[model samples]
Target: MLSFAHINNSIFAKSPPFRTAAKRLFHAALSQRMKIIPISVLEDNYSYILVDDKTKEAAVIDPVEPSKILNVLSQTGAKLTSVFTTHHHWDHSGGNVELVAKKPGLAVYGADARIPEINYVCKDHEEFKLGTLTVTPLHTPCHTKGHVCYFVLDPATNERAVFTGDTLFIAGCGRFFEGDARDMYRNLFHVLMRLPEDTWVFCGHEYTRANIKFALSVDPHNEALLAKAAWCQDKTITVPSTIGQELLYNPFLRVNEQALKLAVSKSDPVEVLNTLREMKNSFR
Candidate 1:
């Protein structure tokens, strides 16, 4: 299991600086064929470049900043063959039209027709391939009716990752903007939680610090959450938190627990989740 302590040590063993440590850890962990580059865009949003080393073919997820993504592609020497649009939100699919203009003939995959320049509409639980990597589009509708989280598997080493655009965050979840609490509950518990425990979670935003703050408010005595909160104090990039780690810390994933149920004076998981979302909306 990749604990926060292990992650901290794996990152900062040789270097004291955050950026240097992160870069070293990122490269060191890329022993598998799949390589992920998390690019910061629009202040807090994250755009990822997932590369298949064997084929040198790459796919960009929610590439809001095309210029930044293009620059990274140049450095990696990987061909950008496709775009995985998570939703129809402007921040997620804003660069679709422009990106297609720059690099035409790219397959733009999305579930919503509202997504600009989207050509391939992915169905629920649709499985495809990007090079040797297996891509599964999981339709998680809560933040939006068409929100889809991309679950990718590296068959060579059995490594897994889920690109949860807005449906799921590090220790929190996105607001139920389009759907209700029940939709979010099913999306979180049924769809996402079914993935392997070690599956790395690459969320759409850099909101770990803030999410941890709120998580601690509801589940204050949780040692895992406390450890994560302390680890996040000095960390700027907190992507790639595993599904097991989230189950240990994230309050959203702990709705069935008695502590979370008592936090909002609710026994039913759905009610607790609903109350928790309301509290989060008003928190700080």
Candidate 2:
């Protein structure tokens, strides 16, 4: 006497207790995955704590103070494995000495000697494993001669993100202090842009609002930029801008777009980048 609908419902439905226990287990499993926590230090700087929850191993990127990082480690119950430095700027490397002093034999990685307490000088294109996560260091030296970006990927899944330390921002790129516009073009377009469009961008600053303002000035007609401006107004959503969204709205990445080219009055991408950078340097 069982109808088809009743049979289907019987097969699919679960008892309340069973569903509750399943939900709890699902949440517990999700919580055990690798996580990236952004710790804002100084005025606009962001130091990240990349933690692999299953193994409870952690790496602090560009720490400004040891106490903040120690606090995170204590909260997560994760042991400090190493520190990743994107560039040698003082704000980015300030806590390196103290962190190493706290965790003796901790491997601090960077591209140059300027990063304090750098025990492991990472080379470009090198891959390092941190628990279930795999990190590839991309040497993007235009920010500084030895600047590098750490690209983190979950080998078992399509989950990937890049830690762009001062080299690239949310809607803008870094100031070309040590290199020319050409270096930036190569690093931003040729190097970083080649990654999957969904790669999460975790830059080193809370400059998204200013950067978006600059972007809207040059690329006003872009719907993505317009929507993003509306969303970003009076709010701080700094980390985790995707490559796809940036390619759509970021003027630095959209140098070849006709609207941005006209705004900058330049045709060549590098020239457009130079013009945009100069404009941003003086942009309110």
Candidate 3:
């Protein structure tokens, strides 16, 4: 019902500039173009709508509810093309059936073979395109064996944004439900940490305030952690921290920090990660 070109143009105009301009200039300059929309759902989950204003085609990520997302598409006048699932968790994938029912023949992409009505099963490092937007799927298996995040490159602004489902949160990581501390360590430090410092992290939940509180207990001497915790308390707002910010305040992500290393009783990155995760699990 919506004009695709109008929606595509709108997103292109709104996309932010690349966080690492210098590093991405060459690669991003030659990539496809697209725009993204983030729709918050289910108290903390964020469902994203990636639309190419020029083509009016759109994709949604981790939709927990359909009505809200459908309304957004209608209001913005964008045609829904696909749905991307990070994992098969109920909270993250519950809306799939309703959405598919509404948009018959719509393709739903996910790494999990167990997800309902999955038409396009994705793999790690797999690439897909919608209009001018190019999305790369990173198979991060800590939260769930098939959990995957989508890295979007918008050529119009030459920027990058990642939709990190449950694998990564604003200032915390997901619980090791299907994987162990080591898997999460690799996912956070080796995989995600390798990205640009300024990459806007559009995570799954709004648990920033509570996560930072626990982080403060782990590293009481961390000025940034304390300050962020206090600010979160004062404003009663969830901090949409970036990966760079997490490196500074998130205990799980800061396994190598001298103070965190000391608290965890280990200098080894993996051990530090394990200790921190254990502490957080018991933390009230």
Candidate 4:
């Protein structure tokens, strides 16, 4: 098994450092566009601060714990200008009212009317801005009828990240609480997966360890799954997994693969996904 450091180094080693002055300058530009700080809250949930370095303005995603979010904002000196709630779940949107009370005039964006203090109810593919970052809200309605995943891009560097609340996780996916397999398939493959391969995936919960365990059970022979398990063993937080990396190990995204279909004795992609979710629901 590879140590955590070795695993990270190996994954990042594919891209060698830039030696040319122009390339170095490009790297610097990429670094300054956006900074994502993951704030762990309430057992396993994650609330994020998306900071646009150029403007010193930030947006908090699923600010479930207002105090922690406020503390980070104070430390970073980034003015909290907006709130991006992925869904109306209490764990994800619980802090909205408190957060708004503390900081007035913060634009609270979401798709559901049930979302606390949701002023800007978003439509599918509604594009908005925060400082230099362009945020596109994609309607992903599996986890909930109004579930949404925020896809944020910094045009300056073209850097991307998605805040997938309960829809998609590192190696596993959320339970089919409100919708069925078809809805989840669309959320995972059709919507979120369609983003650029390098887009960073910041999900709602830090359930990587448990999710990887379940993933390994179904994909025991998968090299990528095994490597991911090893990589996360020593880490406490695992919020940001890239789309490209998820395609390799996430079984939910691999429903079309022959091996995964065989694992559940199904060939049709949707049926395979359905069976996989059922199996996951019961997996210890």
Best by TM-score: 1
Candidate 3, residue 272: Cα displacement in angstroms equals: 1.4
List the candidates' TM-scores in order: 0.91, 0.88, 0.84, 0.89
The lDDT of model 2 is 0.79
Could you tell me the TM-score of candidate 3? 0.84
Q: Scored by CA lDDT, what does every candidate get?
A: 0.85, 0.79, 0.73, 0.82
RMSD of each: 4.1, 9.8, 6.9, 6.0
lDDT string, candidate 4, 170-210, tens digits: 99898888899999998888898899998888899988998
Q: For model 3, how does the per-residue alpha-carbon lDDT over 106-213 read when each residue is reduced to its tens digit? A: 889999987777999887777888777778888899789989988876666656678898888866889888998889988987788888876667788778787887
lDDT of 2 by residue, 1-284 (tens): 00000010112111211121121211322433556666767888888888776677888889888887787567657788989999999999989988888889988999988888888889888999888789999999787999999998876565777999998898899999899999999999888999999887889888988988888888878999888777766444346677888898888999988998899889999999999999999999
The superposed Cα distance between candidate 3 and the true structure at residue 281, in angstroms, equals 1.4
Write model 1 residue lDDT over 1-284, tens digit each, in one string.
12111121334222212224442434445445777777778988989888887898999999999998897778667899999999999999999999999999999999999999999999998799999999999999879898999999888778788999998999999999999899999999999999999798989998899898999899999999998888878766677787898999999999999999989999999999999999999998
Q: Which pairs of residues collide in model 4? A: none
Provide the lowest-lDDT 10-residue window in model 2. 1-10
Give the runs in model 4 whose Cα sits over 4 Å from its true position. 1-31
Clash pairs, candidate 3, are: 4-56, 7-53, 8-52, 8-53, 8-54, 9-53, 9-54, 33-132
Arrange candidates, best lDDT first: 1, 4, 2, 3
| Backbone clashes in model 4 | 0
Candidate 2: give the clashing pairs: none
